[model samples]
Target: MSTLTTAPDPTSETAQLVRRARRHRSRRALRRTSALGLLLAAAVVVRVTLGDYTVTIPDTLRIIGGADIPGASFILMESTLPRAVAAVLAGASLAVAGGVMQDLMRNPLASPDILGISGGASTAAVFSLIVLGLSGPGVTMVAFLGALAVAAVLVGMSSGGAKGGTHALIIVGVGCSALLVALTHWVLLRADVYRLSEAMVWLTGSVAAASWTEIARLAVLAAVALPAMLLLHRQLRVMMLGDDLAAGLGVAVERHRALAMLGVVLLVAGTCAVCGPIAFVALLAGPIGRRLHRGRTRLVDIALIGALMVVVADYIGAYLVPGGGNLPVGVVTGLAGAPFLLWLIVTRTRVET
Candidate 1:
């Protein structure tokens, strides 16, 4: 008689399946992140090398190496190079902020510009420029404080609500944003023609005039914030499963969320103060990164995707348009981002209904 074969344990079979799925996701993430990194490098090279005034790659390298290569030297060093670098920094900053907030809130719709954090910063910066006659660092400081205040209010309100999560934050944030926008309009209305013109340029979100000093400041902000964001990824993923589950797993959900929220504010405010509010980089970057990775996304992946979008858009705005007039990088992103936002709203509605 044949001995009866023991059956396979269901639990063991299930564990194997889980392990297999996880490995698949890990491999996908690695492939996608590598591809995005390559794309970003290529975008930077193209922006530097193939402009209205094309410079050879060898000459571009020489310029970076501190060679005085005539017309190429001044244009590449003073303007085009700086603009591309700033776009990368600012776009990466916006994306990380968005990725953190979206992950924390479990909502793709929770970006700074959409929720009015940028508007609050803009309102304060405009006030400083017009009423207080502040310039440079003063405006940046005011914008930072304003973003912090708005974010603090949002957290307080959301936590105070009965449900106290995505819906509450979105509702309170939209209301605050409207109020901030109105205040900005009021400030602009009161300013003289010269100040009004200056405020308008900034409000449009153009980095056409980005300076080396501003880029340096933004780069430092990124250095501090990007690592902090990556460090929180594990905590954020835990919370995404549910607050109760996260708490049970030994994660301090509320405290971590607040700290993460503060980081978002720092990133948005710094970018606003330096590059103006480049619309939709934050809103668009994380979702795209998640799709690309086909798994839980890395903050760096999201950041590189954002940098690519902005650098490419900035290049198009500066050089690709039929009209000689340069489009503001903000305008290009807004045109592209607004449609995506509408699509998200529609898609989300269908899913909810």
Candidate 2:
């Protein structure tokens, strides 16, 4: 019997390299995810236990476990708990939305707020609040519809088909955002003092009045949307290599892109409905998450980081301000985000130069 020897396939080395790279990325993502998860948990504990009306950790644990602690019970159940939950959900949603947008567009500057989804939702919400006199669930429904509509218009305007038309998308989105913002201002200007004040607070963003109903609504939206995004993770990773490459790999580029945009819209709309447009959480979360994981973007890490940012910012607004009066969470985030934005612009300019 003669033994036949076959030469090794030349592509095996490349395949091995690809597998190794993927495994390395997965390990890094896992480590970052674990770290962020722990940090987010700690932040939530701190947020719930430390406030104007402080609750000890043990007492908080007891309250969570169904123990009836005196002063802590009402405050925890009604106020701190709900607010913290809202912060986490809103932050995570915004961050995930932003990450998806950035990855889709391959533009660091692309975020739901910047691309007009949040603005559209805010405008619709304000109209519902002031003109239609809608509140609660009605406003949320309007906001969701408005976001979806704007996203559809944006995608159509950009012609983001098999190839992601990022530049056109950005231009159209920014213009639309400007128009929507102007309309929101006009609505606010014509409103009565009481309505104006309430609208302003909502526009500026706050979880101060967070309720169980709002929490439940956000929870449901997140439950539905986040898993969908996760399921699209492989497509997202593939698309990062460019549309043609992604399409060649058996990914339906346009379809996946549209699905990703839908997921982003849902996240942003739900967040806006619950807490209004909390500035820069989405914009900042992706970059921060990437940095934390040594420049690898993991969706879960981004979400956790976003949650941490919002929880910490809310804590500052509620407790760290000099006066007894609380600031809106948006105000704190805006203040923080503006500087970061400026730095980003300057750095980008430097890089271009």
Candidate 3:
């Protein structure tokens, strides 16, 4: 009766709170993933089934499972399947890359397309195509190299070398992008008609020429990069709290940031190599994913949303364009993203005011 009870352990309570928070985040992530997964599945079904050939969903499934469904088999195997796969891979890769960049930079406007990474890749690929006469994987390799080079340049130009603030990096990136885009245009102007036509279509970004080879390449890249990014998510979260705090919390800010940049470069380069810089999937995916999940941004959800966007956009370009000719997926995404970009600027201005 005279003795007082011991107080509860603060460490134990803190641990419990952390566990609860983790559990809540896990549940939220699962729900978001499930919803986005269903959307992606639907998009894939529509992409394969409702194309110019019109394969039934059942037939599409059967064909995918190695059943020869007579008329649908060839179409599904040769064109539609590869195209759909390419769109999904390209979109997911770009989205994840964009999400990583935005998270690292702590800027909604930061993305491969906006920050000159894609432009660098595109410019290099175009140069290889027209000036150097490189073909096949050579162009892809050059694109990758170009992207890495741009990343290096951005880092150097930033205020604190590789650990600079978001604004400096973005500003430098925009300047670099403008330069690269000008070079791309100059290259286009110098090309002969046939080569120019090919480059133009590629620059516009289409999965129309998607093949099994391209799919396999993307699959291999994703197999390596996606899991690595997932593992780095904790570090990314810490990094989000600013370098000083992150470093104080035992995060190697520069090293982790460099690693993240490498992953983003690989992803962006790979997608651009295959799909030729499909516009805005990277730029829009992170924000859309956040909105869909009630202001949470999970990389997997963002990737799925990006995949859905590309597939749906491609479908619309292929079958729904007012004029008969198919437009590039890039064009559709560009049209969509431009408005969103304007809205972002307006809202940001209003907020600042």
lDDT (Cα, tens digit) per residue for candidate 1, span 222-308: 999888988987798998898788889999878887888888998999899887888999999989888776546688899998899
TM-score ranking from best to worst? 1, 3, 2
- Alpha-carbon local distance difference test for all models: 0.87, 0.88, 0.87
RMSD of each: 2.4, 2.8, 2.3
**Runs off by more than 4 Å, candidate 2:** 1-25, 160-165
Candidate 3 has which clashing residue pairs, if any?
none
lDDT of 1 at 308: 92
Candidate 3 error regions (>4 Å) = 1-22, 158-164
Where's the lowest-lDDT run of ten residues in candidate 3? 155-164
Q: If scored against the real structure, what TM-score would every candidate get?
A: 0.93, 0.91, 0.92
* Tens-place lDDT digits, model 3, residues 1-353: 69989999999999999999999988878987998899899888888888678988777778888898777898889877888899999999999999988888888888988999999899999999999999778888999999999987765554243444677788888999999999999999999999999999999999988778877988899989988987886798887777789888998878888888889889988888888989988999999888876766689888898999999999999899998588889999999999998897798679879
